[model samples]
Target: MQALGPWLPDDPALPPVALAVSGGGDSLCLAWLARHWRKNLLAFVVDHGLRAESAQEARLTVQRLADMGVPARLLTLTTLTKGPGVAERARQARYAVLAQACREAGCLDLLLGHQADDQAETLQMRHQAGSGPEGLAGMAWMSALPDVRVVRPLLDVSRQALRNTLRGAGLAWVDDPSNQDMQAGRVRVRHSLREQDEREALWRAGLQAGAARMRRDDSRTMSFARQGTFRPEGWVCLGPVLPEPEDLSVLIRCVGGQIYPPAPAAVRRLQAAGQEATLAGVQLVRWRSGWVLVREAAAMDAYGPAYAGARWDGRFELFLPSSVSRESLQVGPAGFGLDRTVRGGWPARFCATLPALWRHGQRVGIPHLGWWAEEALQGAGFLFQPPVPATGGGVYGWPEARGAWFAAHHI
Candidate 1:
């Protein structure tokens, strides 16, 4: 674990840390180290309920951690409706449960044990899938989850070393039956990588290349952010020299207010779509001397107003005073034909796409537009945030401007 010193954040004021432990060799080693590193470590186990042994294994795992003096909790997930992508679905559910638990416990850091072998296996899998550099780069040492930061400290360490450590410490770990299922792509890839030593070099080179690429992109993205015009109306205008696909992905997520960027193929098409196109629910058009990104009017989300704090269109977070009742207000787009005189200089088309508060068949107000009708609501606040944090920096770079877009529009 001493090898982790260079990668750990220097801030000593970090909140209690959370680790996702599965009672497996990798995670168990992480749990042990985390217990010794931080007095306030919270261990979370997600029981996917996919197999008969899952429940008992979860209990035994937590019991062992508790015996080791680690605070632990088991989060049992309801069985998912049988799906084609059971593995992927289970993975998503697992992360969601862990992230929620971290939030509840006021932990910002979520640790995982993904060793060097896992990194090499990932690179192999992505390469076989015809992935780009971003995908082939494998996992980052640190990645931002919805609410928690995922720290993978074992990326440079070998899985065999971790297992040896556990065995030497007399720690027993549950061997998941699913890992041996050859039907899974990861299992197949893992077996192939085990026979090839060349992949280790590829893994190291891929990570280095990916990181160097990120550094170059970070500079480009920062310059774009400084020079571009990101309007409160959910539009961003940038120069004609388009950014790389990775940076374009970030821009699409931010401008479209989407939790995930569109697929790589879709991003490439959007980039080559000349002066106008729509992808990932975002419309891109040539405006003046540069490209502009805006939320596609027909694709935006709409929700009925809630009592106090309400999110509308997945773009605006609304906080109405207690005097306001949600039943009386309709929350949706202003749509075409909205009068713009009171909206100041906001573009008519853009203003029409804003989240409008409607009452008694009239538009009362919109976020960033100021309250128009006194009876509609007084002392109301609005915030513009996408479903996920916009990693304003490009691929593999620090999130230097992670929340800048939200901050600018949070009123």
Candidate 2:
């Protein structure tokens, strides 16, 4: 429990916690700990449905938890499909299922049972992939998972100790056969670590190095950039001086609303262009003072008129409240095309992508810019709220690396 202290909420008045239990030794151990820690807890067994035995395994996991008086549910992943990178895709689908369940259940934090062996394997993989400090640091104890906080309280503990606890309690766990697959890099790495004399030392050094790397990452800040502006409308502009590689990757993701960063080669090309260019669905322009990045208007998908909840280019959330009949009203792009009369002073490229209200194919209003036709319909206005950052960390605005370093190195 002392090992779990650093990752838990400071408030002892605990909220109901959720755990992702896979019927495996590590996760089942977590189930036991969660039951001991909090009287109010929820456990989920994610059935990836990739194998014939998976469904039975989930049922058994639920029964075991029920025996312990801990209510558990089996969430099945139904959208799985056979394909290349099936394992990776299944992993993502599993997390998506878990995250959605947590949100619906109002559980802000979700616990996992990753331990020392998993940590070492992750670092080994990252090192082989030529990862930088951030990637080499391996997984953090706490990470932003869309809407839920993913907490790994057992990162510092060993897999052997967890299994020992289960053994002492007379608890049995399923051994997933995938763990022994020699073809998989992770399994191979795990086996190699077991035979290595320096395994313990390697794990310790990696954790210490990872901690140092995280401290450096947490200390990163926006202070170094000449100017940086992140708008509520999902556009950002950075200064004449380009951001560091790490910061630039995050910036691209934020403006593009993409989960993955632009390819390294693509980013390097953009940096060298120093002019108008587009990458990862984000447009980069050279403003007088510095550089500006915005979502590419041409790349946006068109939104036809709908009854309610109209979104523009997946960038803004739009809601139109009306008492009158909405059959005649339609929402579409504000065109700056030929013969179109658009109020000037704004970037023509950006204005074309703004949400426009129309009536019988006639332009009526440009909501975000506050433009309305002389005789516009009543009870009609534009209110758009961008979705909150799915993952909360030092990615956007100021980097937390500076703060992390200060806390670690200060007198």
Candidate 3:
């Protein structure tokens, strides 16, 4: 519990902390530990429905949590189907639903139960896939997602230790058969780590790599503060010289509104090209003194129904006053038919990618450029909130640095 100080804030008025309980021994133990740590907590059991017994397992997990005096909810993923890459698909779907649940529950932090064994397996898998240094770091204690932070308090603890904790408390857990499936890469890695020495070596390797990665991130953050200007218009202005490849990737990811950055090799190639190029739905164009990274206009999503809090293009969030009717309003790119005089010196390419408000095919608002059709539309606005920050958050005790960066940039 002392180690969780950096991850959780001590505030009573905040929403309850959340846990992702899979009914497995690792997660059940986590729930038990969390129950003792704080009473204001919520647990979520995700049912992928990949197997017939998944729903029942979820229900059982919820009941077990109730017995532990922990409030829980079951999230069912209905869109997932068994096919090629089913494991990856199920994992992605699970996290998506979990994040949505956290948002609806007003949770700022979502605890996961990935123990040391899982981290070792991840390290081995990434090593086999030729992952870079960042990937070799395995998992961070805390990862800041767009909507919430995913935390792993037991990353350094072994799976057997967690199971033992549950057993000591006279608790039982559901054992998923898929864990022993040899066809799965993670399962294979888990089995290979039967030797304590091998597991400890892998865990140590991850720790060393994570320490190095944190040092790199610190330098990267300083570099961003020195040479990059993040505009509230969802674009980034860089100095005359292109940033380091990693920093460049961060800019592209933020401007493109992507959850992950473009490949490091692709970023290196972009930097080598040096003049002007486009990658990962972002275009790097030469502006006045430095270069401007902007979203590709053609890659922008089409108009979708606009409500008071609709998020458009994954980059901008719409806000409308209660007085405005959402019947005919739509949110999409600020394309043609807009008055040119209201552009306010923003480039046409940049303007075209901005999230705009439309009603029945007529342009009504371009919040970034401060243009609205009428006085009634004045209250409508859009905030540039990308899926990932230019300086990604994963290190522990780094929120203060992130908050300071945002404050200095007026983001």
Candidate 4:
């Protein structure tokens, strides 16, 4: 309680919180407790509207919240997708809406009611799939949700214990029938007697072991990464990576964060950037033997003169400097493959939109290629270059303002 005091401010300073009350036993207990401890908490009942009684349940939940003196915000979600995965899609949409609501309500914290049993089920599922500790970090106690933070305070308390608490307080609760249906994925893990004890034990043990290994590994990786960033201490964000069984294959974080060891293949593709290549979502600008991942220009920037690689009307061999060719591309043929079609290099966007200034291998004005790259171009390939209608627009030039020293070449 003492350790958690910093998070719990005095009444006047207490930040409002958005509670995701599903009318489940777990969340009910959490709302009940939070309502008592915090004064300005709001209850948000998100009805996925998947079942026949979902709306009615939402109504009952609103009434219950009102009775408890916590104002309720009702949200309903329309169905998306179909078949078995429909439920998960609904869940995602529900959270998306809830997250937006929390932000709109001027609240940074969103509370959830997941308990220990849910964590156990997750562990069992990962164990069955032969996942290592990386997969078993388990549910986070608190995590970022787009713009909101999801805090699960009832994970340590059991569902049975919560029911006892609710009943002890003369409160009635509605049970979600979907939880008991064998069709739900989580139900199988709970009922699996044959694999239950052993799987549970190994996974539980592995989860702890995995956490320890990650801490150790993270410390070591961070030290080496800091050395790499010694040149520009605060300019770049390079630190230890999150623990994973395999090398980091894909990433979405900004550059200032830790730079995990790129896959051997991605490293090679980056090295062999004779023209342009896409790894993960970033475009690699290859120089003699060095390359840097750059955000491709924005879709609205307009494509400049076509790169020599993209201009090849027929098959042509392009020579590379001796130093640059020394490194073999691990990504092989597929790694270099990006659609150069004028419609847009990446299937996701149009090429005319990508910033044209970066490829010239020249200095750029925008520091982060602001608005230059809406999304990274995909389908970039070395051997394959098909000419399509080109996006004609004003070409990008060196950063006139910074007047920084850069290569003699321009893209």
Per-candidate TM-scores read: 0.79, 0.75, 0.89, 0.59
Off by over 4 Å in 3: 6-14, 336-339, 396-411
lDDT of 1 at 361: 72
Ordered from best to worst lDDT, the candidate numbers read 3, 1, 2, 4
Q: Encode model 1's per-residue lDDT on 195-266: one tens digit a residue.
A: 435655755665665576666556755766676766766677777766667667767887787655678887
For model 4, how does the per-residue alpha-carbon lDDT over 1-411 read when each residue is reduced to its tens digit?
122222545344655777898887777777888878877888899888778898899889889888887888899887554577776677768776886687678777788887656666776776676554444555555554335556766544455677777877777777888777788777877777344345445435534654554464465456435432311111112232221213222221121121222344454444444445654434544433333333333311222333222212111112222332222111111112233542232332222222222333431211111222212322222231111100110011111222321221121
**Backbone clash numbers for all candidates listed:** 0, 10, 0, 21
**Candidate 4 TM-score, true structure as reference:** 0.59
Against the true structure, candidate 2 reaches a TM-score of: 0.75
lDDT of 2 by residue, 1-411 (tens): 444343346343654578999999999989997777766788889999878999999999999999876788789988898667777888878877887788777777788898767877887776676665556556667666445777787765678778888888899999998788787778887877764334545555565666665455544443433357775545667878776666666677666655456666567767766768888888887767778777777776665764454555544545665653567777776777523244455577767666677778877767566666734344455443332231244222111332321111111
RMSD of each: 7.9, 6.8, 6.7, 18.1
Better of 2 and 3 by lDDT: 3
| Local error of candidate 4 at residue 225 (angstroms) | 4.3
List the pairs of residues colliding in candidate 2: 217-401, 218-400, 218-401, 219-400, 219-401, 219-402, 220-399, 220-401, 220-402, 221-399
What is each predicted model's overall lDDT from 0 to 1? 0.71, 0.67, 0.83, 0.48
lDDT of 3 at 47: 94
lDDT of 3 by residue, 102-125 (tens): 989899889999887888799899
